[model samples]
Target: MQASNSPSLTRSQLATELGVSVFTLNQWAVSGKGPKAIRVGRQSVYRREDIDAYKATISSTESTPAPVSQPIGSYMMRLPEVLSLSGLSKSSIYAMSKAGEFPASVKLGSRAVGWPSHMVMQWLNDRMGNVA
Candidate 1:
């Protein structure tokens, strides 16, 4: 791991900067599609230069950078918002999640949980048949 004083972005920070989800970053890391990260104890951190290089490579191949899928505030949604968006009640949501029919909630604390907005949106999009 690089020195803590060195410039680096934690996985969550990089996900925010790149307008993606931490879950997405994890998938990218596993598939070797995202910027290289250094393991720092139990967490991963991306060096500033590595992120810049990754951005450059992406820009070179794509006409334009990808747009942010969701607003910063909506990156994670509490139960209520998820319920409203999906038009499902709390019990139904929990049931569906348990059955693998819904995106599972991320644990925010001992009693708090949230769903990644991107995943929920993707699920909705899939159900809607990619409707605009």
Candidate 2:
């Protein structure tokens, strides 16, 4: 539990500060790898000190530089490829696409659709909090 006087950040604010999406933060929380959080009523909050310590740990352990941005050319990714890269179920992808949460697929032919490769890579980078 955090002290009552400590400053805290909401999940959304922390995600923005870390250059990642809220969904990514949620995944981290579930995996038990993110900064510790304190529950405040219905919300989860991160103490400023905890966030700072988490960043320090990451910076100290990471040896490689951040990933570069996706290449300039556009390429299409079929469903199987998308699933492999994203680790999301086909239904989740379609549901997220329909809800405008995930990138929409492009129509390749009468019955085929594919996602842009660059977009998928960008999304993955964003989720990994790798700014490029």
Winner by TM-score: 2
- Write candidate 1's Cα lDDT for 25-73 as tens digits: 9999999998999999999999989998999998888786587475565
Clashes of 1: 0
lDDT for position 56 in model 1? 97
Per-residue alpha-carbon lDDT of model 2 for 46-132, expressed as tens digits?
A: 999999999999989989878746577978899999999999999999999999878999899999999989988878888889544
Error of 2 at 5 (Å): 13
- For model 2, what is the alpha-carbon lDDT of residue 83? 99
Would you estimate the TM-scores of all the predictions? 0.44, 0.45
Best by the lDDT measure: 1
In model 1, which regions exceed 4 Å deviation?
A: 1-6, 64-132
lDDT (0-100) at residue 121 of candidate 2?
85
Error of 2 at 93 (Å): 29
Predicted structure 1: lDDT: 0.89
Error of 2 at 50 (Å): 0.4
